[model samples]
Target: MKNEKCGGAATPRWFGYALQSLVYLAHHAENDVRCPSGEIATKVCTEATLMRRILARLARANIVEAREGRDGGYFLRKPPETITLAEVYRALEMTEPLCTGLMDTASDGMIGMEIKGAFSGIMKETEQLMMTLLEKRTVADLVKEVYEVKK
Candidate 1:
């Protein structure tokens, strides 16, 4: 669960599902191993419908490709090494960050404005740091980490 929220409204779980789907695909990335949504959903423990939506977003980002018809399925359009965690975040449209943004958006006068302004600055800085770190990590890097843990 990569996109776990700390507070505020809960984040859509699509990002985690998308990452897991990418990681799953990365392991079988070579030679264009296309797999159906059912199979991927089964492996990732998510609904097929949600997986389809997530995969559609990834495909739109050129991270994955989809084929139609009976033999149709999904395959990585780009190599795992070229796919960064930041790319996944971007693909999922996670521009608004989680955590840091406290207080409701009720606009409680001058004090509220000042508080929100400060929180906005902090949120931006925090999100920037997160993206910087994520940009350094790729799907291949994560796959390697998983293998290491398994060993």
Candidate 2:
């Protein structure tokens, strides 16, 4: 069997889904007043249940609002141009990088501490950079970028 590491210290799944769903909602903002969970799942190529869970998280964060019953669905609580990736990141509480390794405390006592400090610094810097980028570019910006790329 291949030693495939699953669900390591990576960004939580909800973060990616929230980001993707935000972008999608922003792109369809003009046309899509309210998007059902199934539609969102289809567009994002994710399972309905997964999408629902993601949407629920976003809703909890106030990034998106959910409505129940017929003609009920999800919609961006705020304009996409105002939404930032940092907001989503914070909402999802994703702190670690995409990949991380456990510190070997036995081999090196101080080394682990040093590595952890360095990693913390790097993460803080990365988070700030991402926040700055996200602040400047909103969901609409993502839509524009996507359109340009598709063209």
Candidate 3:
């Protein structure tokens, strides 16, 4: 597949782009400032149109608020500390994880079916663990991480 705008290999390129843009905004959201999509595009290195689409989805999720006219732009709907990475993941991802095929029962025989069941169970538990971590982290946490890294 073609590389996504933000250089991530996620099935849909926009997922990574959206998260990167949000991180950028979270870091730069000083004074409750609203920034235009084009400004965000330049900072995050994506096309302005893609930023608009991503911002629109975030707006619908109430992760960000969109404004209109000359002074119009996008701003976080809530404080960065209040928005979990899991919330953004839900807004950007529209499908189950790519391992869903493992969830299907194998018609080959009892062994194949049993193996599929075992694999599916493991995958399900792993996914839940990942979700738990994401739910525990927020945009503000990510910003704090960057500051810590710089030290």
Candidate 4:
């Protein structure tokens, strides 16, 4: 998926899509059913291609599994409660730093350069805090938060 820049940072659109797809999978996991990419995409308000790309990443991360043929699709590789949000975030393997554009502008002068360095450190700390919080939560937690008492 093309990285869409927003407010000087590339908005993590893929992350949001991945979370939606994962929660859907979690809800359906009770039946042990493999859901089609198209069905998940429809449910998540995204395109099948995008869903496939995101799921491919998740598959590599071992968060989900995929199959082929007439009745093939994707399913969770583990229980929702076992899949942490941090794992999901890391699965996307996002390359763009969240302060991309802002950093670019930081090349203006001496103060800009110093501020850029400071910003870089701040970003790193922020990410660490984010991961720590995410590590404490799982897909099941999110599913519960969204659906409340899962069906």
Candidate 5:
């Protein structure tokens, strides 16, 4: 018998939110001004706590910075064009796609080895493709695309 493990889905919810928030921040990065957290949450139609968590992650990645005090909020740490989507994706990617159980069987059967090799290859290829595509895109690019779509 061949035992094999499978990877998870394409992207997580946090990744989606981080991408969206990055685009939003890039669109306003030039202003070099902070917006209220509540306002930002409302703009994205997400809960403030959720937004805060995402912002904290971004801040830790040095993609954005947060300020304290009544007049403080959040701002981009660097120019939008300098921040690649790949970087943001990497920052929020906290889990591996495949589980280890696939190859954890007590008996190493011929079929199991073949399945593991094939699945590992596919997963590696998929990850590479995704990384390439994401690296080619920047926050500025996303913001521009959004503007064009609106018009």
Candidate 6:
């Protein structure tokens, strides 16, 4: 619905935000500094509330850790190279196949049922393929990509 280039339905909007935040964190991590949620949100150009929500998910997944109080914020739990994109995707708890809603428009007749079934199978395969690709990449990889593009 929104006109944002959020990687569309194949990738959830927060996923992009999360990765960007992670890359930012990873960079600051090299300086041994923890990043505040507001800073990360500003860098990613998103609301602090939404950024916190995404960071909470990442924390729960053990991809990042959060601290409380004056010097508290968030940091990666593991090195960026060790954290795969697939882990981030799973951390977001995406329960359904991407674009599954497209199949919901099928008719109520037998033909519709068949089409739905076919779509279900296709969606499952598509998700599997996507996961396979994501598993090979990591936050560090994305950071390198961003730097390269800037060069």
Which model scores highest in lDDT? 4
Q: Which residue runs of candidate 3 sit more than 4 Å off their true CA positions?
A: 1-13, 96-118
Which residue ranges in model 6 land beyond 4 Å of their true spot? 1-11, 107-114
Q: List the residue pairs that clash in candidate 1.
A: none
Residue 136's lDDT within candidate 1 is 95
Q: What's the lDDT of the predicted structure labeled candidate 2? A: 0.70
Candidate 1 per-residue lDDT, tens place, 27-116, comes to: 877656788887898888876776787788888899999998888889889889999999988887754565534645625888887788
Cα lDDT tens digits, model 4, 53-90, are: 88888999999999998878899999999999889888
Q: Please tell me which predicted candidate would have the highest TM-score against the true structure.
A: 4
Q: What is the C-alpha lDDT of each candidate?
A: 0.78, 0.70, 0.75, 0.83, 0.72, 0.82
* Candidate 2 lDDT by residue in tens digits, 89-137: 6766554543334323323667766687676666667757777876676
Give each model's clash number.
0, 0, 0, 0, 4, 0
TM-score (C-alpha) between model 6 and the true structure: 0.82
Which regions of candidate 2 deviate over 4 angstroms?
1-10, 95-114
Residue-level lDDT for 16 in candidate 6: 79
Question: What residue pairs clash in candidate 5, if any at all?
Answer: 2-112, 4-102, 5-102, 7-97
> Could you tell me how far off, in angstroms, the CA of residue 23 lies in candidate 4 after the best superposition?
0.2
TM per candidate comes to: 0.78, 0.71, 0.73, 0.83, 0.74, 0.82
Cα-lDDT of candidate 1:
0.78
* TM accuracy, model 1: 0.78
Candidate 6 weakest lDDT stretch, 10 residues: 1-10
Root-mean-square deviation of each candidate, in angstroms?
4.9, 4.8, 4.7, 4.2, 7.8, 4.3
Q: After superposition, how far is residue 107 of candidate 4 from its true place, in Å?
A: 4.7
Put the candidates in lDDT order, highest first: 4, 6, 1, 3, 5, 2
Task: Report lDDT (Cα) of residue 145, candidate 3.
Answer: 82
Q: State the lDDT of candidate 5 residue by residue for 39-125, as single tens digits.
A: 777777666666777777788899999998987988889888898988887776546542334445423788776677766766678
What TM-score should be assigned to candidate 4? Answer: 0.83
